[model samples]
Target: MKSAHQRFAGRYRPPSPKRSPLITPEGAAALKKELENLWRNQRPVITQAVSEAAALGDRSENAEYIYGKKMLREIDSRILYLQRRLDLIKVVDGLPADPNKVYFGAWVTLIDDDDNERHYRIVGADELNPSAGCISIDSPLALALIGKQLDDRVELNDLDRGYDIIAINYVNATST
Candidate 1:
């Protein structure tokens, strides 16, 4: 029953999400809102629905009961996950005072040698998504970018794909 991902360890646990020790005022508020919304709004709604469905009887044939219970379990699981995550969390919502240097939460625009441009927001692992223009702080590119100034150049390499040296053109807070 072990999937390939789990074959090595019986399950895959993504590394713990990375976050800066401090949060921007905005990031902090958002995380708080998220925790509240999940625990308060979502948790109770799912719980009540599951209880009502369970009362309908014929448990084996009850689609509503099955689905509702599953949903409830997911909600409770996420609530527990968030509780643990938040306890370990350090939100970095504020931009570093030195806008010239790349730091956690910096939005950077890079010009690759091939003349292609890419925009990235360096963020904590929990907040990073390629489609959202965010990258994890611990990623190779972000690691190289950190503490670098605007106009600095850096390279990223993969054994199979060669490497890229991009010049940093801009650095700012992505919040705006």
Candidate 2:
């Protein structure tokens, strides 16, 4: 007969890929703000709720206690992750030596073959938001744009697409 532990062995999972440690100053600040809110505001409220629920006894059957404990665990996990990531991340601030060339935190404007203009800000993975036109520096498109100057043509062989760099700026602006 197979033992319970042997019968229900955990599934093997591959480790996640390593993310770049680079972040924009804004991104770092946002992360710090989130950590602060979780630690100083949310956690205490949840802790107090859990304490009150525990005082009612019969914790095993108390829904409030169970839910509160789960929330606390989730908050703690996020706090730990933020702390570790913050420790290793490098915040990129200020303009690059050549503001005309694409670099981390640069807002790049590209014109496709169809004459459609697209704007994107190259930022760290933590700050990527497609709707906001922010792309990760480690992304393929950002990789192709890095070190490229205005009016330069970029070809992505893998995607079979090409774009022309219309503008590159260190500041956030819509117009070229």
Among the numbered candidates, top TM-score falls to: 2
lDDT of 1 by residue, 1-176 (tens): 97776677745578966555443345556667887997889878877877888888888899888887888778778778767766776766444677678887777778776677787877666565799777878788888888888667777665222223343323344434
RMSD for each model, in Å, please?
4.7, 2.5
For model 1, the stretches where C-alpha displacement exceeds 4 angstroms are 1-25, 93-97, 159-176
The C-alpha local distance difference test score for the whole of candidate 1 amounts to 0.70
Candidates in order, TM-scores: namely 0.74, 0.89
Error of 2 at 155 (Å): 2.2
| Per-candidate local distance difference test | 0.70, 0.92
The residue-level lDDT of candidate 1 at 68 comes to: 79
Q: Could you give me the TM-score of model 2 versus the true structure?
A: 0.89
- For candidate 2, write residues 52-125 as lDDT tens digits: 99999999999999999999999999999999999999998888888889999998889999899999999999
Where does the lowest 10-residue lDDT sum fall in candidate 1? 159-168
Best by lDDT: 2
